[model samples]
Target chain A: MKIVLIGSGNIATHMGKAFMHTGHQIVQVYSRTLANAQALAKLLNSTGTDSLEAVVDHADLYLLAVSDAVIPEVAAQLPQELEGLVVHASGATHIDVLDKFRHAGVIYPIQTFSKSVDLELTETPFAVEAREPADTSTLITFMSAISNRVFEGSSEQRMAMHLAAVFANNFSNALFQVAYDLLAQHDLPFDLIRPIILQTAEKVQNNEPRAVQTGPASRNDQNTINKHLQFISSNPDWQSIYQKISDLIVKRKENNSEN
Target chain B: MKIVLIGSGNIATHMGKAFMHTGHQIVQVYSRTLANAQALAKLLNSTGTDSLEAVVDHADLYLLAVSDAVIPEVAAQLPQELEGLVVHASGATHIDVLDKFRHAGVIYPIQTFSKSVDLELTETPFAVEAREPADTSTLITFMSAISNRVFEGSSEQRMAMHLAAVFANNFSNALFQVAYDLLAQHDLPFDLIRPIILQTAEKVQNNEPRAVQTGPASRNDQNTINKHLQFISSNPDWQSIYQKISDLIVKRKENNSEN
Candidate 1:
């Protein structure tokens, strides 16, 4: 199918290159900024257009890989009587926003992308949703071309996944910052905590995180917890975080024991 | 140098094997539980003893690899007139607990160990601290035999590293539990979020965690943040975590910008 890329951002650049690498035809690239569109278009060896109105109507898929807020506005600007599946690449946006189009769906990839870092699609999951079964199949086919880990999920499930990712990815990354800050306070290099951080993440790949819960709280070692808290006595923010997470771990462990 | 493992626990088991593999003679394995002592002793071809009275006085090193709370009690029970550098394998415990011995030090390996897992010492940092410079040299030499990643640190620095590990290893691990739970609610398997989790950990390996911060909060994209908060409105605990971490990221970014 001939694909028209919409948006020349990180996701767009990544997907465009990936699609081109897989021998798919990207007919045109669209971005509000012509230079951005042309840059990506040149890479794909396709035409570039600043106007959404200039997006080729003959393309089989027009991926509105724009930011979440601009999805609806971008969809609204598309040429009428389109003969293709119009999909937005957003985890949070619902499919209803593309109601103006006859065939609409979503292709939400669940990984943070940096164009500089090569993305291995075999591990990156693409949670796809479509209004029509046929379109879902189309997405699965196209996405599977790049990645084997494509699944058809509902809009609610996709958005729920977006929320879940915040917990899994964003929040966990912040906890890393907390660790870095703690080490920095003592003039300790981040290298001291590097291996353990990798090991912790690797552990969860094959094991359930809850089952592998560890640390002073998990061990019910209040003595060490007190020592840590007192060590960071000047930082109330760190103390609160430590106390709350510790209490939660202990409380949860007790609950599990009772059951 | 001959070594006596003071406990047949996780840390002791792992370090014992690593040391033995590196051709260090494990003279004895001591555990309060006799069976536990014999189990580890069998692997190392060393003596296993339940009575601290039976702990050999001829060993070059007596490793107090026991629990933190019982360190002093266990130290008091060790045979007097011992002829080796006495060391405790604890991250949180101060070296003072082992001061009863003429030669006291710490060999705190900065990695969580499980007997079931093969510990790669090249990545596992052993932070050594001794009251005397000669003892610290002895420790660095011994530890460097198995792992070249040995460094001399003060008691305060070692303890701070312990607290930092809690944030890096433990708290971040709990966040993975949060992700698993979120996915479980929708009957989604944990596999979907596995790649992102690994990537997040890998990103911080070379870069500062604060610098590599990604997601809605990192972008300060209030639109998605509001959507996410509303989505998890039913779960107060999840909401609180989301809001607090998001606010923290936004505030930290502003501070960084000002600086």
Candidate 2:
């Protein structure tokens, strides 16, 4: 498959490498910065350009791995005569955002990408949504070449999944930040808590999170809760966050019991 | 080291097995229930009894692996004539609670214990806070036989670590539960977000969570935040939680910019 890669960020870097490895031809790499585009293009052994006008639509697929806010603007700037399939690698944006082009779709990689890590694309699930049936198959076959799991979802379902990721991944990571902050404030080594964190994560691999919830909050040990409240009294905002989450845990337990 | 593990509960079950595997002789097992004590004793090839008075202090170490609330009452019942170190494997209880004994200390296993999983005690950290240097060394060697990491920490420090564990592990798991609940309310499969949850946990392993935070909350995208709030508004409690956490993240980002 002939593909044109857009954006030169973390996701773009990994996606470009994977596509190249799968014997796909990367026609050109486009980025706002010349150096960024050149860097990926050199890796792919392809042409590179900074101008949106230089984007050639001669390839079978054009992947926009740019940020959510910039996708529509970039699409609008593309030449109307460009002939190819277009896809955006965004979780939150709708498919209609690319409606200006004859063929539009989404090819979202449902994994956290870092440049240093070795990613097994087969483990990463791809959520593909297209404006047309033919476009869907093109994206599906392209993604399936790199990943073992490919599912077709509507724009609304993808939006909900994206929102849900915020709670499951983003919010959970924020809570970890709070924990790190609380520990550092007390001159505690964050490494000491690593085992517990890993084990907690491993628990969910087999069972439900609600089944594995523990601590003073889940135990309803008011004495310990009061002591923790005293400890975090100085940071009122964090203290409030702590209290709300604890209360929510207790309430969930109650709901589970009634059920 | 010769040891007698008291209370054949979750911690004792794992600790007793680990001690036996490390070639330490468990002289006796004591529990409130004779069957529970005997069950652990049989595993360790030792005698078992129900009464705390029946506890014969023949070993060099006595590990009281029991719940926090029962520690004082159990310690008070132990015979004063007993020799060797006496330690309770608790995260929150103070070591001085066993001050009546000549040798007293703590051995807190930082990981959550369940009966189904065979716990690898070699990686488990034992937080030791003893009344004397000799008792500390005795515990260090005994626990070190089974665990690689052992540190001297006061009851207050252990309590703080325990609280932090709640935030990092227990409370974090509860947040996952909240996500599950929200999805279930909308008749969505909890499986759809599993990949996101796994990635969220993996993100913190390499980066400080404060730096890796993402989502509508992290982006300070009011439109999406307001939409999520409206979606959960039927449940006022969840809506308030969503608001508080979102506001906290936004505030943290602001503080970061100012710095």
Candidate 3:
């Protein structure tokens, strides 16, 4: 498949590499910053450009790997009459945002990407959506070349999945930052809790997270919760988060018991 | 080393197996319930008892692997003039809780444990605390036999570590539960987000979590955050948590920039 990658950020870099790995041709790379596009295009052996008019119109797919807020604007600037599939790689954005194209779809990779970390894309699940049944098949085939895990879902389902990712990946990492700051305040190394973080993630792979949930909040251990609240009393932000999450966990546990 | 494990719960079960793995003899396992004690003791080829009077007096170490609330009562019931070192496996409970003993310390493993999952103890960091310097060496040697990661800290330091673990492990898992519940509501498989969770944790293994943090919250993308809030508006608990955490993240990023 011939591809034109839009946006020269983490997702574009990773996706371009994955497409190249699967023997697909990346014909052009686009970024508002010409240098950024050039850097990625050089690696992919493709043309680099900052202007939307320069996007190759004849590619098999135009993968808009841009930020969510920029998707609509980027989609508006694409060649309106282009005879290629236009897909945005965003979990939060709806497929209709690219409705201007004859062939519009989504190929949202349900994984976090960082430029510094090399990820195994084969196992990363890609949620695919398309306006036409034929385009869906084409998108699935394109995704299958890079990943084994692909699912067909509507925009609503994709939004739900994105929301869940926010909690699972985004919010959870925020909690890790909280942990890191807490440890650093006491002159402790983040290394002390790294094993536990990995183990916690490992447990959720097979078991239902709710079933294996172990903590002061899950147990409704008020003494420990109070102690933690007291410990973080000076930091009202953490105190509220600590209290709110604990209350939520305890309530969930209670609901589980009643059911 | 001769050891007596005084608890038959999750920590005791896992710790007993680890102690036996390192060639330390578990002389006895004690629990309020004889069946629970027997269940763990039978696996380690040790005696199981419910009565505190039956605890072996000659063991080299009496390991109190009990709950934080029960530690004081459990310690009170032990043989007062015992010759061996006494250590509690708790993060929140201070080492001073066992000050009645001539040789007192702590052997708090910083990893979350479940009986269903087998963990490689060699990499699990054990936080050791001792009343005397000689006992610290003894505790270190014993811990070294089971794990390469051992550190000495005072009670205050250990409590701080425990608080961090709650954020890193427990609260992080709670966030996973939130994700799981959200997906289940939409009839989506939890498998979709599992890869991201693993990758998020894998990144933290070598990188500072604060440096590698990514998400709407971390990015301060209020557009996506507002969209997420609207998506979850029906659930008040999640809404409050979402708002509080997003605000906190934005505030934190601002703080980071100032520094």
Which candidate number would show the highest lDDT if scored against the true structure?
3
Range of the 10 consecutive residues with the lowest summed lDDT in candidate 3 chain B: B210-219
List, residue by residue over A1-259, the lDDT tens digit for candidate 1. Answer: 7999999988998899888889889999998999988988999999899987777888899899888878878888888679899998888899999998889989999997766666777668999988889999989998998888999888888878888787777888888888888888889898988899888888888888877777889888999999999999997777877887787678778988999
lDDT of 2 by residue, A72-141 (tens): 8998998766678888988778898888888889988767666665677786777898998988987888
Q: Lowest-scoring 10 consecutive residues by lDDT in candidate 2 chain A?
A: A110-119
* Top-TM-score candidate index: 3
The sequence of per-residue lDDT tens digits that candidate 3 reaches over residues B43-146 is: 99998999998888898999998878889999998888989999998888888889899999999999898878888899988989999999999999989988
Docking quality tier of model 2 = medium
Alpha carbon deviation, residue A247, candidate 2 (Å): 2.1
**DockQ for all candidate structures vs. native:** 0.73, 0.53, 0.83
Using lDDT as the measure, what is the rank order of every candidate, best first? 3, 1, 2
TM-score of each: 0.95, 0.90, 0.98
Q: Which stretches of candidate 3 lie above 4 Å from their native place?
A: none
Q: Model 1: residues >4 Å from true position, as ranges? A: none
Chain B TM-score, candidates in order: 0.94, 0.91, 0.97
**Poorest 10 consecutive residues by lDDT, candidate 3 chain A:** A210-219
- What lDDT tens digits, residue by residue, belong to model 1 across residues B53-151? 998889899888888889989999887688798999888999988877889999998887766566688768889999999999999998998887899
